[model samples]
Target: MDEKRRVAAVWLPHWPVERLYRADRRTRGKVQAPKAPLALAAPGQGGVRVTACNRTAAAAGVAPGQLVPDAMTLCPGLELRAADFAADRAALKRLALWCGRYTPWTAVDPAGIGEEPDGLMLDISGCDHLFGGEAALVADLQKRLHGFGLTVRVAVASTPGAAWALARYGTAPAFILLPGDEAAALEKLPVAALRLDDATVDGLMRLGLKRAGDLYGKPRAPITARFGRHVAQRLDEALGFAREPISPLRPPAPFRARGIFAEGLTRTEDIEEAVRLLAGELCRLLAHERRGARRLELTLFRADGEVTRLFAGTAAPSHDALHLARLFREKLAQAGDDFDAGFGIEAAMLAALATDTLAPAQDRFDAEGADAEALAQIIDRLGARLGHERIVRLEPRASHIPERAVVSVSAVRGATPAMRGWRAQVEEQMAAALAGSLARPIRLLARPEPVEAVAEVPEGPPRIFRWRRVTHRVTRAEGPERIAPEWWRRGERRTRDYYRVEDAEGRRFWLYRDGLYLRDTEGPRWYLHGVFE
Candidate 1:
């Protein structure tokens, strides 16, 4: 028979407390917990209440979800800290990245609001042998996590659900269930081990289904009908009858490299050197894969449990190490005082966040080709230093309205494929149309400015107009092109009678008369809409 797939679940019981304590340690430069019971509070229905508690608080009978007043009354010396959900999530994501040393498939399981425990799931099917055995891998994981001053439970089983149950609900700190042994392992555990909600678990317990074994022989339909489909689904997943795939925090990068220092490096020069090395390594990997990175991120892991991330993007996909390193350097220079190396950085990781197929370019003897490449590189550098939002290119949009005809998008990322193709098709059509028509203005105003004008009667072109506090007599006028607003979009729209007029000084302008004079009781209004070279 084929061997069953193995999954490992690593549970961090008091993640919030640990995260708080670590932050405190970093600030105070000491490894000490508060003398009094500590709790993290969140706003609840019954005023502010405790959402998480440290061991000291839990030992003093200060349970989660308890009112702050009651907890303080129970332990008068209780300390309360506001919950930092964003910080906790960031820490968990960094931990997931650190776990990449164990398996490529690692996902963070964050606790929802009001939930106690949070954990990580890793698919370690063929990785156990590398660390001696399954048990040895778990032991190593536990030891490494303990070194980081975290309390954790490690469990391995044939399925992710089974491993999760054993890790969080099992009696031991570490446990492993062999293939086909999940049923026996989970039989005596509480129904909560199936990852059911409190309401469902309560209902099951009231029905005399406290342990998983109580419903083992029962019909699936009745259980599902009573407690809902989640109960049956969780049970089946735990019993290896269903598949549960983990969505990783970040998709695995196609090209990546890491540099680890024995002792943390604090100097900026040293950090840059490490980044340069990583860039070279990543470039080699990309060359081997025949792909190039368009977006890259450099992550610095500090000794003080802080992670700093820097981003760089390219106008085009590139596999050149020096160019990539220069991009990172530009980003670092732009960061100025924002990027910190608290306590010093122990590891640096370079990841290609977005990649695309890359092939060798033709000979660059052509000056235009070289100029184009140079321009792209310049744009990439400027974008890296000045921020992508500040470096923009005008892209043609699908609109007849002058204000909506073009959009500004980041030059580095360029336009979307659909937008680019649509613009190309529109340009092709416009080229054919413009071949027989008069030239359009070089610059169009976002909003046309109202103008006072004198024109011939019977819908003729303007003879003179005053715009922007200046009067100009029309020396030449050649248009009465009528452009009507989309009647299908709205009712009672105005039709513009446009005229291309040149002044005595040879300055040309696009003037439009709004509405029809005979159709509307009020006469038409004139506006200056654009300028021509």
Candidate 2:
């Protein structure tokens, strides 16, 4: 096992980020509640006293998910509104950012990963000198987050588990573990801090293993048999007896290019020229690094102490300077008509959010072969003009039906193909299908439209019917291929009998006759749905 170093674990206590967003909506009175509680009460703005009713607020009578009306009934006057998770999250991210001021290895607590999250984790082993020492560093962090309106706890230990347990469970005296004394230090802490499931904790509790020390003396075989090996493993890790791997959340790749205004820039044209200069410099940097950027960030630092950041990601990695500048040009065109340039802009930094290695080009190629560099440049220019969403390629989907055979996603050029096993299976199924097994159209509407029709059928597609108003006579018709709707999503839907027909002008059309003739209450209807290429 590897020797453990100084690791400090930080959790947000609760999901503070979510709480922040909730405050924003609730403050504007935009929140609709049976009786909304005020979120933005000024320091001295007096309102009715509303107390939380759990043991912490529950003991006061407030239960989680209780409606304002019901809660008011229980306490006569309960001040309650939704929690502001966004604002809380923003505050938490800011704290995470500030933690960068402490150590570059800082990351947001994992509480934001799923619904009821706890806190963040930081690996501060060798870099405590900048803030003096461990004790002083923890004190500084606590003061900062507290000033930002957060209740936080810091724990420093040799192992992540010990630090996490201390932060969440251990009392004040043992919050900061000393060197070579983890066993005695963790003895009194509750077993729940081991990150075990509720059932495991309950089962351990029933076995009289209340404190972490209680499980310390248990034999490995018996513990493994009775409570499973995870219990023993967690105990060993927390007690510094077994090794546990710490996976620090990776920050996005750092790729930045900056431009300083000779004189402060205030006009849109000045910003554009600055952007072009920065993009060109960024491209040179990317070329030097032998990588292409997939996302570009433009940060404008205003003289008024405000930062405005714009982000645009490519479907593929590219380092074309002219193409990069053009992408921002389209975005700038869409800015508000009354956009104000307060004070002036001092600097701009363009960063790459994603990147890929460009392949070395071959010296010679066949005449008919595509030029990779030319293709990339073309894609970059088109991506800039049409917007990222507009340029895409159809990726094959794993369905036997023609309509479900492919899907259009934001195209990534030269991307690694998705799961080979699944692709092989789909290809095998599609290989055996007959060309005329079903009449399929080149283009299918994203959604189906309903139409009224009097069909000559033992319940089949209509010959003469009105669709998007042009009544078409079915000269040639194909058999009905029924496609059932996915019932789990929208419940039971009308069944479709699809047919390919040539209209009066030899224009080919794909139509669907929905429902059966006099099926239930509604009559059979014809829908001119798709055009054949």
Candidate 3:
């Protein structure tokens, strides 16, 4: 059996086409803010000149290499503005996804934007039978997308090259083909059908070989000699004189559930009922396909033509509709409060955005890992209520400096690391040291506050010292554990002598003195910082 394909091409008018005007520029809202490309160059006598025109912009009477002033003069009352590349790209991607109903295999054309991604290629293969044969399938796609006001041209052929050529060059009932007749069908088509460069096409036209048929009947030697190898090469491939590969855009991730309400569901209960039915439908499809979902997406259509999306992820793959419904309950509940069912949802789609493979869980000696799942659910709930950042897990950073350690991550998804082996022992020791010594204030100042002090000793306990306008008498003190500042870091480096001192009130304090007494006029100063409760 010969391989037959039904390929459909959608013309994104915004896509660069030569001299063809695009009106979609008006759709550029605040997000993109694209300027209009056409403007009335003053009510002119004949026509207006183009100011800044691209190939597609020029095709609309804004020709390339044409002076903007001349273009405005040629076509008066032309709307001039900047092209919104972002909006155009987004619309193209949406069109690709919309094409899914026709075939699982659809690919975008090599040409984009200025080149105008003319159409998409679909290797319908065995799938066309589901839509009641090739012609009906094309008709169905045309009817649906045309409702959206899209201009589409489709062609079915034995090879991608033949289909592509006919779509661009042929007319409607836009498809053309005959079994084992590739050469004859493409014979009369222009050289442009082979997707050759503009320079090549112009050169071929000048040589009086305007059509593929003209070149097909002529001597091979002279055509190659005049236009070089690339021209003849593309012609040969399009005519199936050489093998041409078809790279269809891989079908997007499959979505199994589609919901259509009986009377357009308006109430929350009605929507939930619809959602449950859709989830069940998806679950059945997933089971039949022998796959499980990791992430599920629910798309809700509001009566007013608004689409709302909800997303959920599982720790493991699942195909249970009830479980999926539970995950969506919170979101669906909220949607009822916020959404205005202007027309009632016309359509809804339930899809597994991600899936994973796994074997069935066996009965365990102890209860399975529900704790982790429950915690995840709670965290997710808290994150939804209070911004995600408000609920976080503190992860210890591998640094000795207290402030350098401990980072925050969303509590819902992050896993706490186990402090095992030497690390665990060190943490335990640090905990013990803090707990046994004294009750320390939770907030520790970044650094000690320096203060001028007078001690009675020649290296003995201080009799009196004033710190921040408070006088203190140190009755006893322990020897200092001197610490030197890091000299490599260029700044005011210092040496510290720390002491555990008891004041006259018998209250213990941690104090440090910066720099040793030298011949400099300044004396050693003490600083009281962190409090030991």
Best by lDDT: 1
What are the per-model C-alpha RMSD values against the true structure?
Answer: 5.8, 12.9, 8.0
lDDT of 3 by residue, 1-533 (tens): 24454345443332432112323322431132123344312222344332234333445566634555666676554555544445555555545544544554667765422353545677677666766787877786666544444456677777767777777777664574664676788888887888887888888899888888887757778878877887777777666666666565542457567755557777777777777888898888888777887777776755333456677665446687876776777676555557666556666777787876645665566655666456656665554444456777656665433344455655644454532234674676589567653223345457778765666664444556677788778787765656664456566445666666777888767677766776324666787756666
lDDT of each: 0.82, 0.64, 0.61
- Each prediction's number of clashing residue pairs: 0, 37, 34
lDDT of candidate 1 over 135-225, digit per residue (tens): 9889978886775668899899988888888888899999988888888999999998888888888899999999988878799888888
Model 1 clash tally, residue pairs: 0
Better of 1 and 2 by TM-score: 1
For candidate 2, report its TM-score: 0.46
- Residue 98 C-alpha lDDT in model 1: 70
Range of the 10 consecutive residues with the lowest summed lDDT in candidate 1:
109-118
Off by over 4 Å in 1: 1-6, 34-115, 124-148, 156-158, 165-241, 251-259, 280-294, 356-372, 395-439, 455-463, 473-508, 514-522
Provide the global lDDT of candidate 2 against the true structure. Answer: 0.64
TM-score against truth, every candidate? 0.70, 0.46, 0.60
Question: Ranking by lDDT, best first?
Answer: 1, 2, 3
The Cα RMSD in angstroms, rounded to one decimal, for candidate 1 relative to the true structure is 5.8
When 2 and 3 are scored with lDDT, the better candidate is 2
Cα-lDDT of candidate 3? 0.61
lDDT at position 461, candidate 3: 42
